[model samples]
Target chain A: MSLRPLLIPALLLASLIALFGALLLGSTPMEASRVLAALAGMADATDVTVVWQVRLPRALAAFAVGLALGGSGAALQGLLRNPLAEPGVLGVSASASLGATFALYYGFFSVSAWLVPVAAVAGALLATMLIAAAAMRTSSVVTLILIGVGLSSFAGAAMSLLMNLAPNPFSLSDMINWMLGSVANRGFPDIVFAAPFIAAGLTILYAGRRGLTALTLGDEAAAGIGLDLRRQRLLVVAGAGLATGGAVALAGAIGFVGIVAPHIVRPLVDHDPARSLIPSALLAGLILVLADIGVRLLPTEFELKLGVVAALIGAPAFVWIAMQRRTISAEQG
Target chain B: MTDSEQKFELTVEKLCIRAGGSLLVENASLDLRSGELAVLLGPNGAGKTSLLRGILGLAPTATGSVRLQGRAFGEFNPQQRARRLSYLPQRRPLAWPSPVRDVVSLGRYAWGCAPGRLGAEDLGAVNAALAACDLLAMAERSTDTLSGGELARVHCARAFATEAPLLFADEPVASLDPRHRFRIMQLIRDHVSTGAGALVVLHDVSLAARFADRLIWMKEGRITADGPPTQTLTESRMAEIYQVQADINGNHVEITNPLP
Candidate 1:
């Protein structure tokens, strides 16, 4: 029997538990009773401040970022009809990071905090538009993936050039921190700024979920089934752009969660792309939350960056997933 | 109107399809009525598939006027067109390992039902399609595990599930064994007998002769013959279109040898 019916609810529960764990296992660890009391607004001001002002926003930010990445990854995988497609692999996240880097290089945060995310969104939209235009020109999946690699290389070079020309050590360090990707010191304002874009992006992906399912039969068959291919491409591209941009703005640039999350949930849903979306998002959120907790718990002079921790865990998972796919395809052949 | 009295017709006029700077199908015209199964037969690269795609408006550079049931094809939106006409292209690679039932249920997409959320009517259509294609036993099997012939049947079942008035299939039985090949053709024949129309592309002349109510022979982007199978599947016509010496005995054709 298929486990799809229970997958989403289970992921939701796991995400809540992980979020609670995030709250309970911070630098200043608190008892479960104390944390619950703080959540209920029954604790003293200092405890409430620690829970509400500090851990809550950080946890929520991590979840939102993961939600964006995971949802975008599922939408893109469906659109491209490739299991490996994701914001990071498609160069969208890198482009968004370059935009954020530019914002940091120019001291845009001092001028207005919102400008950073705005610039990141603009960068993501630009990259996604380029990819979408190329997709229209070619029906070749390999060509699209190669073009994404080229785009990513160019963006990485641009970011490196920006960092190399930093005006001061402080600016260079700031750029490095942004590139490393952390949810540390994130506050309610950051979540407030990024939430709408993330919400809108996920909403768009959700609306186009059925089209993604139709795409599993390949492009010609999908169009034969009466799906408007152009419209579906637009929805996926635009949704992934907004979501990835929002994610980068929220937590620098986290990799692999997007790819790994959907891969984990796909089998549960019998590999149905439409059904994998929400479950992927929830699982990714849980992963990032757990990663954040790991980051805090590690014994180190400096707290581990969430992106670093994610890459540490996720890159291996990515390779394993790729190897598994190769084995399956070879077996089928 | 009762099902038997309902009218279904597809008309194509002066259809031209160009691809990569070369004309693939030129000035093709045809009409199909309910209770008719038309098989398109030609040699390799004879533009049979291109003509079918052109009529379906899937060819990127197709220039044609097509009408269904007396209304212009362009007047309908994509979903509405899908509701009226269902197409089965050459067997395409399945990207995901979704269950067979789920894949077939995608045929109901034009009617606004996604897989796993099918309404009673949509479920009925899906089940009927599976049963029609002899796929009910394997409905829960993952597509990735199916053999090529089974996968081809799954696709045909998907097309059948649409329940559209007109069906355009390109090489629907190309990979099937003889038994399955005949079964698929017979299924199309049965579908057409229910007051619908089907235009199937086939390389097997004998199969086409056995099942098609009408035969359309295309050679190099043009229709060379269009008539009843008995009149169109002649020895001389087969030699002209396929460059083969052939023996035609009633509805069976034996390709004797290829011309030098």
Candidate 2:
């Protein structure tokens, strides 16, 4: 009994429900009808402004970021043949964050708002190429993770250096806040900036799904099955880089949605890594929207960072998933 | 002995493959023709696997050219090469828990159609492969849950699904039970009977004597003997190359002593 036909629709429905819930929850309780009216262009000024200018774009951006991460994570797991492979684990997000922060420190955003994201994407591509090179040299998961950790630590240090060299306290705090990763005060422009890259990245990943499936039998077998190994590596690395770079550019390095979402949905698709992409993306969008709503309603001294809240939920989920995998393997043995 | 066939041939000439600046296979030349089964036998470090990989173009060769069906092996694109030959490596490499049917269908990857969107012919081929390997009942099961013998059968089924003219298997019966060893050997013979050729590596001389149409003995990166099983597994060659004293008795090789 294949459940794939039901899985995508079920996830899309859940995502829509979460998106609607997110749009209805802010400082003031906007009625669902009013939100719908504003969406349909028949609402009053305040309602229209609240729904259109404030809530909708942020929710969509959060969803888009999650979609990118989750899709990339699933694709990367297939590419690397490791269930734990993700953008964060490969240092892609961290390197992109460093690039964005570097652009901010040097006032590139003042010259052109597009510069930060462009820089971020470039940095992500560079990191992805380096990691891909290292991965090609060895198939050991621990060695790949170690290389990624080294790259991540280096990127984190570079970001810290940029903060230290800031000329003013305003600049320092600004960099710090961006590093915290939030979707607040964002408009449709962020979505516009990210959508194309994410779309392109997803297309590349989608094209490589068959090759990825062939790779489940390892490199030689994959080649014997007519998959060009170098081409598959390029597709996956470029796709993951574009998606993760665009995501970090918009949302400032939100964590764990990539790692967590795929784990949540892998079983539904019979553990086929290639088939897990869309469902994982849908579930991740729902998770991010729900987390964004939770942050808005938390009633803290200050609104929580989207990344902070996500890590708070996701880091533990990652630990639990890892432990669960260990138990499963133990039982199998 | 289909070695005289002119329609399909894989020719490896003056092949030299190296890894980490050391030669693994040197000046090895062999020909595989349709409807022939050639079993490669060698002791450990004798470069049997390297020669197989070299012939399949999976390893980098220092100086050599492999021709498949009269086309230079390197000149053929991945799809063309895959359509000409299928290789089952020594490793059991079912990493994911993909369904048995899906995994088997992956053999047709060179057909250039999506697995889920397989044409009727492709689907028929996949079904035939599953049925041929006696895995029809386990088609829906996940490959991760399969036993060692079942996994071997599934892999063999995948190779069979290619329907290519030439097959290369490295130590395909390394760790199987006696029943499965017999089954895998019979499966290879059956594949060769279908007018395709197979080059399989094995350590068991008795099994090789039973199933192989020809035997090629390798020692230290060179071909020591290449002929029919009767002529290649002589007492002196076995003693000299494999350091074993063997007695050949009517399609069975009995190793009598390990020469020190």
Candidate 3:
């Protein structure tokens, strides 16, 4: 049999096995047969609750959110034509955090959980508009990147100031949760809240994939291929905003999947930016799910936040990719 | 290459250019007919690049109007204009290693060809473009991994894939070797041989004279001459335009000015 046909299915199988194992094994270990019984709808009440209400939703959230981040990151990097570009680089996540913080600070969540997501979407859109306005005119990608960084820092600092001024425990909790980005305690409603934006973003990106590939050869060539620079940039901005914002609204600040997933998957796809999307989504979901599973596995009396492990993995990877690109740029271009 | 068939016509009137407080090209007007292989010849900083940019609506294009195929340039929608006219800027800087096949397919963006996705026509166009540029062997190779000559061909493939009626390229041969220069010019000529018009800004007058059906010679913000190569590319016109002495021994012109 050709190994090609087995690649995705094999990866999926390995992931499913790992996920199943992680779900069933822990401080309260469930037997494989019992887990299968639960899966097959023959389990008793307690096993059904444990498997369905808690483990399954958490795992699905981890996978779906990871998919959003990974796909968004891949698309963002290609659209920006810089491997270093990420959702955080453009301040989308920070803006979402600020929005969620604002909602909780004002007791919007006390009225409704839906309000928090609305706030996040609004904030993300505003921040995206600001970044696009500031950086759209210049021919310099470095300048655009720097503007994004500056805007992200501004949003982060503002978020910190809001956190410090917080008068209630809800604001503090919301800020912390938003920053750390967890998929815990999520239900189907949370999934519903995020699905539309992520889908829209991914669609916009997928639509522009060919253009992103063309851009890798440079702007003039991309234009020669009939891509209008302004229109393409607009699409990229809207796509990244919708995706990163939706993911952030759902899971908080879940860091690095967008950056790490694309970089890790690019080589496998032969350095073609468009091909990075599918593999990136898979890798991203796999990483987040695994990380989420690890958080449950940790022996700490209090749960270790998912973001801490992700940061540990992502920070080093970011540094390595940055250093690698800088060293290779002189010889490559 | 029929004489009767024509699609896009670029007309510029009283085009003046001043970049960074220096007048580069002044009061240049041109009526570029459709389906013609037009080449701009100029010395360094004689504003060949500016003129091309002016035509593409890239430059500020002070005190002038550029009509694309009879319509005012600004009146057309940006995407609609892009579909009709395409531009390749000078010394393209592609920093990443995108595949050659993927790079050429960018031409479908104005048409909104989505990712992991292409229709039969798109694939056919991509394959045909690669073949036209002789990049079929390196279709899957990383574009950034190629030599300069190869990179130029990949860009040509991209331009060819655009399927626009008018193509504008600035200094398409600046970094190319001699053999590659000939090849690039030939490919560009082939592309223009279709109903599509092509305008290339070049520093090499001999190459322009050899390849282009119509020559545009510019100096100090003006079109000093526009005609056939045999009439306008004489020794005196070369000396006057370049501010130096030159000799045209045959079809080739050599500059014999004192070394600066």
Candidate order by DockQ, decreasing, is 1, 2, 3
Which docking category, incorrect, acceptable, medium or high, applies to candidate 3?
medium
- Candidate 3 lDDT over A1-333, as tens digits, reads 144345456657766876787568655889999988997779998888788777777787787778778887887787767787777666777787788777767678889877777777777777767766655466565676677677667777888887677765555555667787888788777888777887887888787676667677566556545456777777777777777778888888777777998897776665667777767877788898899888888899878777777888897898898788777866754
Say which candidate scores most in lDDT. 1
Q: Is candidate 2 or candidate 3 better by TM-score?
A: 2
Residue-level lDDT of model 1, residues A1-333, one tens digit each, is 566678888888889989998889877899999999999999999889999999999999999999999999898888887787788777888899899878867788779988888888888888888887887778675687788788778888898888787653455546555666789988999998888889989999999999999998888888888999989988988898988998999898788899999998898887889989999988888889888889889989988899998888877987787787789878877
lDDT of all predictions: 0.87, 0.84, 0.76
lDDT of 2 by residue, B1-260 (tens): 12223458888898998888788998998998988999999999999988987877778654697888778988888888887788899875766778898888888889875556678888888898899889999999988788888999999999888888889998899889999999998988988887888999999888998999999989999987899987777888889789998887867888889999
Model 2 off-target regions past 4 Å? A167-178, A327-333, B1-6
Taking the tens digit of each residue's C-alpha lDDT, what string does model 2 give over A10-31?
Answer: 8888889888887899899988
Q: List the residue pairs that clash in candidate 1.
A: none
The candidate that achieves the highest DockQ relative to the unseen native structure:
1
**Chain A TM per prediction:** 0.93, 0.94, 0.89
How many clashing pairs does model 2 include? Answer: 0
Query: How many Å off is the CA of B228 in candidate 3?
Result: 1.3
CAPRI docking class of candidate 2: medium
